[model samples]
Target: MAATARSTTPEDITSPVRELVIPDPSSSVRWHEHDWPHPLARWHYHPEVEVHLIRESSGTVMAGDWAGPFGPGHLSLMGSFLPHNWISHRDDSAVVRNRDAVLQFDQERFFAAAGTLPELEALRPLLEAAARGIEFTGRTAVQGAAAMEAVNGTFGLRRLATVAELLAVLAESPESERRYLDSRGGTYRLDASEAEVFNRALGYITEHLEGRMLVPEVAEAVGLSRDAFSRLFAKATGVGFNRTVTRMRLTEACRLLRGTDLPVSDICYRVGFTNLSNFNRHFRATTGTTPSRYRRIDQL
Candidate 1:
């Protein structure tokens, strides 16, 4: 595979907005079954809303500011331009064949349909909620998994029904788990100039994901003083600089536990944690499950 474009600078390289050209231009819907080492594996977003399911394996799911562990049966809806990615840690290759079942559709087309269909009127609230990114849970998630799978193999109107049913199931999600991922970032997109600074910072952080990262280092890399950069980044991304790095590292740690047979200690160090207890604590706080339990449950 070729690179993420060495022609661009680290800041330019880090812009997560993906310009998507759907496989079927005539159809509003597009389906993609990607293997890891997949060309689109990095953190990126598109204007089209995405319905995503992890068909096989387990890993970290990053949708906007929300970072969490996900296994098979994991289902999520991402609004237009919401930055997200899934990283699976299977081996040296970090490979998982047929890992995702994804369908992306135009938001404009969806609203156009909703305007004429009363049944789709309920879709308005659900679609609006998608702006901040949403995850389906409980019965909704189980049904969503089945619905997306049904969508994977069908065509014509049957395919349309599966997608509709999937959305309907998610629309009925229980209030507790059908919550938004975050309040900031989904609709409040940065302008081009502001994004350039952040894009560079993102590239710098991910490049050093396995090492101790300093705020000053990133500030210098992006050509700003520490204080100014700190304030700007917090304002721009709605999270502290250090927190972003930790989230990135821990997210990768979740992938390691689920996709590989590595021991907890080794996985901890590999993901930039020098201490086992700290890794365990952070894992529990972020994922609601220990590393061992996370791996075991996913396998079962």
Candidate 2:
């Protein structure tokens, strides 16, 4: 499937599509609250570089081609325009919250601070490569998570020190330990028109994932023909309409399997899978493990 088109509106185009805006990037690192009552399944991006630490939640993490299950101890660095989201599958009553410490500064600020500083200048390539996405798997996450937490709480000079420390730690870490996502390409940004359409479609899909989600329905919602919408959606999201919907449903199913005590059949129906056999097949295909096995592993 092709990816969705870029946004074209001024507000949607100029500003990042985030729920909370962090206006100050020069002072202290900004912390945002992402505690939605229900699971979030929307595909969105921002202009800032994101450092996320998964504390006590599990979900499907989508970042370009890197789509899979992620649980506690997972940390990632997402550059501007790289779309991502954590779709929680836990029951609505269960608290599925994410603790994020984000720093949003442009290339200009980075260069202005580090260009003349010999120590920081050496890490420029690592920062540039992070424009794609970076996932830390081992000790880097442990160290980075602490730094993120400290920066979130500190202020003034201490906060700046923490932020600098976080970047330096991430930059100096061995490349072999950092898992890069979508490193082979340049960064991508959406125009106003495309961003609006894509966000609307994504919102609709998240709300109606438990029901029949047809291509025509999505196209009509976006004021396009089925064929035209299909091409555009594929182009924008890098996945076809059917595939995207299926992935969304499977993501929800994984959440339920890990965070809820619901039975397999119940989970299938809850996530919009009417056919039990088909659900089993697709779930295994997408996750590379059966629902029962996934649940067991997560429990362990």
Instruction: For candidate 2, write residues 122-214 as lDDT tens digits.
Output: 657766877667888677888987877777667788887887888877887887778776533354455656656766776667667788989
Q: For candidate 1, which ten residues in a row score worst on lDDT?
A: 1-10
Model 2 TM-score?
0.73
Q: Going through the candidates in order, what is the number of backbone clashes in each?
A: 1, 22
lDDT (tens digit, per residue) of candidate 1 on 11-87: 22344346464657645689878876565665567788888888776655666766666778888898888777775
Report the Cα lDDT for candidate 1: 0.73
Q: List the residue pairs that clash in candidate 1.
A: 11-200
